[model samples]
Target: MLLKTDLTSEQLLAVIFDYMAKISSESKLDRVLVLMANMGREMIVADRCTVWLIDEAKQELYTTVAHGVKEIRIPAGTGLVGHAIAAGEPIIIEDAYDDPRHNSDNDKKTGYVTKSIITIPFRNNDGQIIGAYQAINKMTEAGKFAPKDMELLSLAASYAGKSLESVMLHQEIVDTQREIIATMGEIGEIRSKETANHVKRVAEYSYVLALGLGLSRHDAEVLRTVSPMHDIGKVAIPDSVLNKPGKLTDEEYEIIKSHTKIGHQLLRGSRRELLSAAAIVAEQHHEKWDGGGYPNGLKGEEIHIFGRITAVADVFDALSAERVYKAAWPLEKIEKLFREERGRHFDPAVVDVFFAELPKLLQIRDELTDKE
Candidate 1:
């Protein structure tokens, strides 16, 4: 660790610029906190640093990234960080034990001694205080924080506040989009008299299957989010054909198959990655592995991987759960069917993944089982 006193003015400015660049490039909230914590620890030469954010909804101060700690949450107005937030200023305690505001519970829990502390309140671009940066046990001979140390932390906090706000806003938008998609998917399911849990189970099953098939965690999560919309086209389906209790006539069957094209057309306009992926899943989930399926009759590898994975997940749920028109098939029967249709109805590799991860898929089904 480089001490603040060791750096000349030019070197200090360069370090600050480097940190700013790194922080600016990151959009994830957790990664941004880690970068800010590291910047504070390095610039102040402290043994540990923590970035605490005020969760207004919970009225708590929480930190996911902290040195030598898993995750800790406290009341909004507790401890040194709380005091700094409450006072809307910086707090420099030469001896943590001597200060009435310092809390020793964390040190006791972690079996780590606390000696010196400096906390600075950070604000968003709107100039509203949002969180605080706290650095503990400055690595000096005296083990105390100085005025210069406070100045260094304050500089880091300024950049951190803005970056945190930006990432938080991005996360909020993503959450809202997910909620809308989920609701729309539920509407599509409800139109055909199916429960919303159908989509939920399919999403979870798709995630498990995706990971089991060696897809990256990010890609798997994206698939989970978009898989619910696979039947969004059902919203445009007529109740007579969609909810028919008896076997459908050939003409009515054709109308049912058109839902795929309808769903794809609904979502294909969006350039967003999630929506675009949903479009592919919506249009191709019914396509068979042997080129005998509907919409485009896309055969084998021509079917998008997203569609193929969802096909397995969708059929698994559809077969295992009770529907308005049919009783839920027994697990033994479903497994037997999957084995028989391995290469004809489904991708052979996906069917293999289905049996391989069957336990996890069953667990998900049990967890999100229909309410009846």
Candidate 2:
């Protein structure tokens, strides 16, 4: 059955605003397409609506959302939708078959005979065409799109462009923030004269350990970013204590141990996620599996997961680094140390994960440092 009546102007405007709000609330591209297609079907009462997205890198179009049809891929200059995109304009055909631009392969795949079609380019705020929005079989007594129908579609597309631009802008902001944090973490490593690459390896090791232990991706990312802060306390230690070529006396050792508490003081009382995780890493990165560590001597599960994961990563990197007081240990020796310390000094689960990825860890070690 075809819809013979037109919706009032006020009703149509309300529906468009509602569609915008729904699209804004979604983050995933697929979900946005689904929302858009469903809204298009209801707003215009079309027999079927399908959304196609442009793969700018590939110069091809791919299906994003579909109803009553299988998806299709068309080159940017291939058919009606493709021509619309290339021309940056909409095309309305009263008889799809009569139009030379109509591609029958899409109808063949969907098993839905195309009577009439409306194809419009979906653009972003910059006026760049991102994809095509097509409604097939407009379900009308006349079986044609009038000038008024085209006007309404143009209006909807204007809003769609702005909405898509908003999403892309938000993603860019998130990527920029992550890059800033990574750079800041490296800066913190440099404060102790440690190589930037060393901090990267520790963070990677922490992420792998968390993933191997069945932590969520979000948790793993948090640990990876926060793990580098484990040694931030070293910045406060005196140069005499930090750069000594020989063993520290009892008095100098006390000053070195104070770094853990000093780090905790520097990072506590933060509500931001990474900062809070950093505070945990600073305060407990040195804590042993048994009740023999400093500050609070928290043992077993009393330690936070971020601290536990970072402890394994920090210790591994330290043993493999060439400090003034110690030579770098061989990978074999580091393995032995982990085996010996399991559940007594290091977390048993973390140690297991470390050994599981020992080969990759060695690769990361080599890639990060080649200087003996």
What local lDDT score does residue 105 receive in model 2, on the 0 to 100 scale?
Answer: 86
- Tens-place lDDT per residue, model 1, 195-308, is 899999999999999999999988999999999999999999899999888899999999999999999999998877788898999999999999989899899999988999
Q: What residue runs in model 2 are displaced by over 4 Å at the alpha carbon?
A: 1-177, 321-326
Q: Estimate, for each residue in 1-372, the C-alpha lDDT of model 2 and write its tens digit.
A: 746555678878788888888998975566677877766665665777777778777888878578865566777787888889889889988888998988898668656688778888878866788877787776656667777777776666667656766776665565664575577567667766677878888988888889999999888988887777777777788887787777899999888888889878887897767777878988898898897887789999998878888889988988997765568998788889999999988989889888998887778777777354
Identify the leading candidate in terms of TM-score: 1
Error of 2 at 57 (Å): 18
Q: Ten residues in a row with the worst lDDT in model 1? A: 1-10
C-alpha displacement of 326 in model 2, angstroms? Answer: 4.5
Q: Which stretches of candidate 1 lie over 4 Å from their true place?
A: 1-19
Clashes of each: 0, 0
**What is the overall TM-score of model 1 with all chains considered together?**
0.90
Each model's C-alpha lDDT? 0.91, 0.79
